[model samples]
Target: MVDLSQYLPILLFLGVALVLSSAFVFLPMIAARFTGAHKPTAEKLTEYECGFPAFEDSRSQFDVRFYLVAILFIIFDLEAAFLYPWAVSVFKLGWLAWGSMMVFIAELALGLVYAWKKGALEWE
Candidate 1:
């Protein structure tokens, strides 16, 4: 047979949370329904960008080089993030971690060199 005591608190907590949230929503909905507020207009519903009039054909294109640089920045930034946790446990990981990180650094260095050779880092 399942123990009812173990689940009692959890059930109570869930019940109370449900009741509290329901009360919160019920009060706001009741108030709003009775307010009889003015009907919304186009100015209220239309999308506004800092009070500028909406433009047609919002589709826009960006430079490919901009995307390439953004992707490369994210990749290298994530690599640095991994280094932090590994560094914290460096003593426990010892030489194996050191060698692994060395390999990783070498790979990144090679990538940097490749980007340099490909003119990916150049502005012009």
Candidate 2:
């Protein structure tokens, strides 16, 4: 039977983390109190983009193609991310995992072809 009380190292680690976080917050507050350099200017207050004055309203309409591509990218990227874990555990999971990943990739490829045919991938 393992003694649960032997977890003193974990308790010490938690205590160190708490102390470090508290110090981080406390030091910043103390420094801000002494530093009289806090000032708001027109340049600082205004939203600057690419070193140019923003000409149009930030809340402008975006193209649907942009959103479609973004969604497709996120979906496929997440699928690829999952593939990494499946690949590492392939020995344990056997041929089923490989087939499953292949199906997933095929679906993504089909989606990409469909998007291309529908002009969803075209920027112009």
Q: Which candidate is the best by lDDT?
A: 2
**In every candidate, how many clashes are there?**
0, 0
lDDT of 2 by residue, 1-124 (tens): 9898889999999999999999998988778768965566887877565877677997999988889989999988898799889988988998988898898889988988999899997886
Measured on C-alpha atoms, candidate 1 has an lDDT of 0.85
What are the clashing pairs of model 2?
none
Give me the overall lDDT of model 2.
Answer: 0.87
Q: Candidate 1, clashing residue pairs?
A: none
Residue 27 in candidate 2, Cα distance off native in Å: 17
RMSDs, each prediction? 6.9, 6.4
Of candidate 1, the 10-residue stretch with the lowest lDDT total is 49-58
Models 1 onward score TM values of: 0.57, 0.62
lDDT of each: 0.85, 0.87
